[model samples]
Target: MTRRNIEGSFHLSGGDFTNAGAASSELKSILTNLGINPEIVRRAAIATFEAEMNVIIHAVAGVMYYLITQDTIKVVLNDMGPGIPDIDRAMTEGYSTAPDWIREMGWGAGMGLPNMKKNSDRFKLDSVVGEGTTVEIIIRIKEGKTE
Candidate 1:
């Protein structure tokens, strides 16, 4: 069995709009520097960005874990905040609970979760109404070559 390569972890503070995409950006840079495929890196970055934004917009605090292996890059985002009441509803496009102020900041179009799912090769989400949410995003890295 192939061993897992744990890359790093990032801590995100809820409502910290000033640093919303920082973690995602750093992940992208790290992957790029590691000579990963651009396309796979792009997908991972987008998924990470969406997850990070969700933490900033909704959660009280969160941690993002980055893991890599011979053929995959996985990101796990765990948050503490008011969790999703309905994962189904939250998955719907154009469905959001963000306040008007958030929208005014040009975000919260309800696309975060959906976009994350779309970009990842595998996705999983878990939430508790009064607790928090956790999202796992995996992007399969192409073997034997970098494009």
Candidate 2:
């Protein structure tokens, strides 16, 4: 992995359904502008969007950080809110704590964390009940000469 040459951060407010995907969109644009591999970009975008949605739907506030090096893309999402009390349960494919309103809006299908894990080459999640949660996603980049 090469040293990071691109980095950015975005903040998310809880319950901001109107702007939930902004960070993911920006990250996707950045990766595209950097000429990242299409598959890697797609994976990164999916993972990021899921993480961002989790923060918007479940946390009081959060921040997302993106770092891109020659051989990888890394994303970290940290949020302050009611943390996951049962991570194992939270990781289950069809379990969700999202309210009905969120579901009515077409999100909170209990797939966010699962999809993030699926799309990321490396995924880590941690939470402390009553405190917050943090998720890290990393995607390996196949290196090639870039003009």
Candidate 3:
């Protein structure tokens, strides 16, 4: 893990569709500036973008934090809203509970989590019914240093 110790946070507004992916993209740029490889940065950006979209579509409001080092990057997402009931089902490739409105927004195809899993080195999810949800993802870049 790189010893960069870079951190940033984004606030996802409730029902703010236009601002989705803004923070993720910003983090991507920062990682790129820190000399993280392009491919690794792309993967982390895509995964983080998906997670951010999930927050906008499913949760009312959310926050995402990015922690970057020379060797590793960690993204933590948290939201308070209607929690996912079945994590197993949500992990499947083609399952979604998005309403008609979200579907009209062109995002209910249920590929978010799958894409995140495919792009990230480590992924974890914690959710409670009627409570909230949190997701953690970590990506490591080889040949990078950590502190």
Candidate 4:
């Protein structure tokens, strides 16, 4: 839990497929400029992109908050979408509720949560049926670390 003051936000549109990765890319650029490790930056960027995609293809709209510190980056994604009825099922690889159209866009491969988990040092989610969903991810900046 590295501590330092940090802040950022990513806004995701409901159907912004054309610009899905923009926010993540911007954050990656910022992190890179901050001298963060490339691998850590990649993991954080990929995870953020996946979350943004989820908002587009599923949630319709959402916001991602970032907390940067000396050694770690924390991301919190919140969305007003059809909540996951079963967290266990959703966490499994190859599980997706995206329609065929979204799949056609190459946006939904049932890998959102799994990829986030794989890329983050810590991953957690809270969702309620008919309510919404929130996901938290933490990535640590370090040298010679591979993920």
- RMSD of every candidate to native, in Å, equals 3.4, 3.4, 2.2, 3.4
Candidate 2 vs candidate 3: the lDDT winner is 2
The lowest-lDDT stretch of 10 consecutive residues in candidate 1 is: 138-147
In model 2, which regions exceed 4 Å deviation?
Answer: 1-4, 143-147
lDDT of model 4 at position 63: 93
Task: Report the Cα lDDT for candidate 3.
Answer: 0.87
Off by over 4 Å in 3: 1-3, 143-147
TM-score of each: 0.92, 0.93, 0.92, 0.90
Candidate 2: RMSD to truth? 3.4
Q: After superposition, how far is residue 62 of candidate 3 from its true place, in Å?
A: 0.9
Model 4: residues with Cα > 4 Å off, grouped in runs: 1-4, 143-147
TM-score of 3: 0.92
lDDT of 1: 0.91
Q: Local error of candidate 3 at 101, Å?
A: 2.1
Give the TM-score (vs. native) of candidate 4.
Answer: 0.90
Tens digits of per-residue lDDT for model 3 on 51-134? 999998888899998887656889999999788899999999989998888989889899999999899888899999898899
Over 125-144, each residue of candidate 1 has an lDDT whose tens digit, in order, gives: 99998899999998888756
Task: Find the 10 residues in a row with the least total lDDT in model 4.
Answer: 138-147
lDDT of 4 at 123: 91
Clashes of each: 0, 0, 8, 1
Error of 1 at 117 (Å): 0.6
